[model samples]
Target: MKKIFISILILLSLAIASIVPFFKSVVIEDGKTGKSLAFFDAKQGSEFSIEYIHSIHKTPVREIYQVHNEEILQTEMRFQEFGVGMPSGADEGEVFAQKGENYILSNMKRTFPSLDIRIGQIIANHTLLLKGHEYPFSGLSEKGSWVSIKVDNLNIWQRLIGGKKLG
Candidate 1:
């Protein structure tokens, strides 16, 4: 009986250790409650974009980022109109241009270990564009709330009970 119990424990440990990493994901969570909103496997250099309509400007806006070394790096942003929070021009080494009706800021190397985004209550319509798919902010989280996005390494336990994944 003792040997059998030891064997079972060893197997369980091995299984947990192996199974945990398989579900590791980059997760987005609600800041107020720490509830997970969504997750996805983001490989190095994998690109994604956040699109939303500016509440005050009522113009379309998109921010592009890339995943690298467990962090998200801002690459560029495009917007239809310049508003209160919009950048009038780019800094040194950054490219700013107007393409059609949209102004673009590109060639940025800003890195974020974690990002906080406030969900727009109505007109913002925050959306996540990843790997040719779209995730609506309304489905991922509640409006008018703050969300934290980061690459979190969840163990086997958290993965087993994780939130929605970006399919």
Candidate 2:
């Protein structure tokens, strides 16, 4: 009986170790641009999915909103310099970026003409909010993510970085 129980316990431990990382993996499809960001290989009962997209230099500023249950979740806002800029469309209340309020902020537009697109990752955090309420969020990282703006209708780093595409 003792031998059987130990074998079963080892099997159980191995099963659990293999399963946890799969749930934590956040995958973004169409990751080249910001069109369709999603979590891949996600568990069925996952409460939230995380997304990360990196576009730099001359990326058009469009509306940013979350789609959930066939309904729009929040208002779209301008993303510049690693922070939320002026919001577009009607007021839909605050978002995770607005709520976090104290994140280190910077813009690649000032010195460089464009920014660099780097590997993105997402993790679960309780501080994320949708509309002033704590909720699951796909928080963009400051150190890894990058962006740039236009100057005189031309990008400063045209040769170094290409135009940022929006979806």
Candidate 3:
């Protein structure tokens, strides 16, 4: 009986070891562009932040928000709506760029053009309000460059083994 129990325990250990990698989170980063892709499991009601780096100055910009209903709203609207001043619908990129400049001038009291505004534009373009528990998020830059974010769901083996923590 003792030998049989030990064999069973070893088999269980091996099974768990083989399944742990599937539950682990995956992250990819771009060395030249400072872009990244991250995939992880997040419980409902948890909050997370996405960080963007300035291409020219190498400054870090962080956008923090809660994950409500498994969605993260983008900082700016991607397209212009047909309303009020925009009867013909304007490009969101141009509109947001101007807004960024105006916001810096009004709030930061800066006269010269700041890269921070461009950073905001990038965040707005790439960062999307994520939806669904097992959905992927792709963050884009002002130049329309993007990175992938994929969340994994635990499989039966992982669930039976109590699952692993996502990184």
Candidate 4:
């Protein structure tokens, strides 16, 4: 009994220690959807942009609005789910595009001259499992559309901790 008790205590301590630092990260709670927002990151180079916790399986994605420079550029909304593999269901990754439109609204368009957006791409990075693949875009216009981005795999947890880094 004594040995068993000591072993249990050690295991418990180890578990707690492992979880402490993880909880230290900023967590945003979206009360509207009842989904807890966790880690977040913006694209490497952009201004006036943000992304946050989107789902349990995917990473939250946001596009930066570069209106001050006044150049024709393209912006993309990326989303991904962790733990879950790439979207397999015929309609698994279709709702997010509309969801983005419903939730994300900034006055970026008014400031920019041309904004071409090709949203929908399942890009697998070291940390994210991208769903909803779409072709990349070039040039700038005022057209926009909804596109869903879901997780492709959750096994890649280590890769996601610091955001996906390309080799």
Candidate 3, run of 10 with poorest lDDT:
105-114
lDDT of each: 0.85, 0.30, 0.36, 0.32
Q: Which stretches of candidate 4 lie over 4 Å from their true place?
A: 18-34, 41-48, 51-167
Error of 3 at 136 (Å): 19
Colliding residue pairs in candidate 1: none
**What is candidate 3's local distance difference test score?**
0.36
- Please list the residue runs of candidate 3 whose C-alpha ends up more than 4 Å from where it truly belongs after superposition: 17-41, 51-146, 154-167
By summed lDDT, the worst window of 10 consecutive residues in model 2 runs over 147-156
Task: Please report the TM-score between candidate 2 and the true structure.
Answer: 0.24
Q: Is candidate 1 or candidate 2 better by TM-score?
A: 1
- Where does candidate 2 clash, by residue pair? 57-148, 81-106, 81-107
Error of 3 at 116 (Å): 21
lDDT of 1 by residue, 9-82 (tens): 99998977866665435789988888887788777787889999998989889999988777889999999888
Instruction: Tell me the tens digit of each residue's lDDT in model 2 across 1-167.
Output: 99999999999988666544322222222233532232322222222211232243322232323333222232333433352343332323333343343222122111222123343333213122223333222233233343211111212222123222211
Q: For candidate 4, give the lDDT of residue 162.
A: 29
lDDT tens string, model 4, 1-167?
99999999999988676544332121222223423222222232223333334344556555434323323122334444423432322232233233532323223233333332233234312122212222131111111332212111122242345232321
